[model samples]
Target: MSTAAPLPAHRLFSPARVGAIARNTLTELTRQKVFYLLLLFGLLLIGSSVLLVRFSFQDQFQMLKDISLGAMSIFGSLLAILATAAMLPRDIEERTLYTILAKPVPRVEYVLGKFLGIAGMLACALFLMGLLFLLILFVRERGVEAEMAASLSGDAAALAAQIETLRAQVFHPNLLAAGLTIFAKTCVLAALTLFVSTFATSQIFTVFIVTTAYFIGHFQATAREYWQAMGGAAWSKAFAGFVAILFPDLQIFNLVDEIAVGVAVPLALLGKTLVLGGFYVLIYLLAAQLVFAQKEL
Candidate 1:
């Protein structure tokens, strides 16, 4: 029988190696046809926004804007939780994890690579969906502008100013910033999902736990405040506080409403979101590596 050659004395955590795994993971996920949700998202936005605009009688662009951003947040959350949660569990279940780990690859690299892949896939989905959303808003803005230009029989300057204001409100940069906040939220959630996948009993368990975590995190602030406001006993207050401290504060990313209405999201807030999200992701990845290292095949 032929003997296998030993691994070369090289860094196991090279970007090239990690990137190869990441690319493969991304390709695997794309083949699963998750990107097709873009079509469903587009259809929902188009169909609902049109009906909403017809019934509301005004502010068509804002209606579309609100709905599109809200949908993006929902889609991003679904992707972050489901994609990362399923990756490691599926590989382990199919014995693919053994095949990879039996080679020269380190467990840490596997964790990081899988995370990068999920994050890359998520970024692509968010961008495309956001683009389609913007395109819809663009068309709506043009139609609204044209209608106003034609309908107004008085001051041309005033009409032009109104259209300009409409343009600003419709194509606001704050919306894009809001999308970044959404992406940041996705990153932290994805990392948490990855951490869970390393130790959960099954893929289904991982998904369920992380999904529940996200919902809890989303309402963490409100729950904490309610419990603190004399509606509960000391133990309940302690439990609520513990839950709030356990999950990343997702309320910080609740910028969709503010951005949808043209309110500026402070630069400082965006910066803090990125920093905190990144910190949580790093912590989760490190924890995953430690747990995975001790995990039996």
Candidate 2:
């Protein structure tokens, strides 16, 4: 009996394989004690913001939101960088990468799997932090309501109006949007770190390069504007353009300040920021695949 022909190379791509790799990556990352420690520290930092009750109610809420969101963003970014920067190198050092690639898995799928794992972990961490933030806001609002009621006991009408206003401010829907923006920013950072890790000689080198890129990305917009408005030389302008294309303009993802200050984030603006973040993620993942495909085992 004649055997059937093997499938084509393009048909070899399998979501099941990608999913398996992603699950394994996620398990490995979750088992690291450093991740738990970092997460606990972040939660404690957020909870500590409740101590800023000396300010007026509005100011107190503002500070609370500001501090909580800032903690999330900073911690989330650090986790993204640390988790992604170490993944590839650790796998290689342990020979897991060789065994995995020795299978039928394509390099592209492998890269995508690794990124998905990181993204999943980030999503879980953000969700936990966000839930705590919302809970804190709810509790603080209740405490403030009690204070307002006690102080304005003689004026029930004014008390109701003030409580309603406080409720609106404390639980603004924009908070959800802000949380999403922070998550998107972290995802971009994770993808960028992964891209750097592909060719980096070691985890330290990958982390260093990604950290530099993070700073450059945050300042790239301002630097570009300064260069263009200064009417600099051709080379300066060329350098600015090159930097702009090379690093993502991370400022666009900074809706935390606006949300903290109670500036309404339009749905359109949130959509644009998320899309831009996703674009950067896709670009970096593609670059990583290209570089990784040529990398020898």
Candidate 3:
């Protein structure tokens, strides 16, 4: 009896397979109760910022952007960690991982597919939150303009100039850059969590480890600066350097404060931050694949 011809090598690494996996993952994630709860909380927090009436218009606008951006960052990070930390362990627990791996799907493709799904979810969440934020800002801007126009009715030229200034402040182009950077930061966290989950025994352990890494990442730059400035022993400096390499410099993605206070984020700086985030994602995904390939299903 003649056996059927074996499939070509290129078919083993097909994008179609990866895309299918990604769509499946995304559907699974969206069905979770935690996803809806977190998204609702984030939207509420952003909307509540508009109720602060004690501050002047300028201060209110600043606070509005600050609070909204901060909420987006926090919620996005939490979602990334929680969602990704559970994926691998959950799949393995349900024996779904075994079935997937039994196919010709490569380990690398599986990892890439999972991360892409999480990334897509994050993008959608950010878009919704950003839309609400922009809406609130627009409403507030119109209200302030009307109030000022009524008070300065005698001076038509001055009213037009003031309205123009308010529009400029409310609609700065850098705000978009700030939103993009926040998304990038969340993607990095998702990738890191995926790497940790590859070897983690349980979902709780993965969450704990990734949460610690998140805190450490925020303080990484500070620790590196202090160690280098103190002129420590070789081992001390070497240890600091090791940490610097292992944990991402999350501060580099912190443009919320600057953007909050109306400081313009340069296009070049935004590009650099995005590039750094992409680098971390690539490195962690590669590392996860290496570990996952040898893992016993």
* Prediction 1 global C-alpha lDDT: 0.85
TM-score of 3: 0.92
Whole-model lDDT per candidate: 0.85, 0.88, 0.88
Give the per-residue lDDT digits (tens) of candidate 1, residues 1-297: 999999677885788878988998999889878888788899989997778766532467777888898899988889888888778877987788888888888888888889999999999999999999988888877877788888884779989898888776677778779889889889989999999988898889998999888889889898888787868887898898789778878888778887887788789878987888899999999998899989988
The list of candidate 3 runs beyond 4 A from truth reads: 1-10, 37-47
RMSD to the true structure for each prediction, in A, is 3.1, 2.9, 2.7
What TM-score would every model get versus the actual structure?
0.92, 0.91, 0.92
Cα miss at 59, model 3 (Å)? 0.1
Deviation from native of the Cα of residue 40 in model 1, angstroms: 1.6
lDDT of 2 by residue, 1-297 (tens): 999998766556899888999998889888885367455745565556546766788888888888888888988999899999999988999999999998878999999999999998898888878887787788888988999999999999999999998898888888889889999999999999999998999899999999999999899999999999999999999999999988888888988998888899988888988998999999999999999999987
Count residue pairs with overlapping backbones in model 3: 0
Worst 10 residues of 2 by lDDT: 33-42
TM-score of 2: 0.91
For every model shown, the clashing-pair count is 0, 0, 0
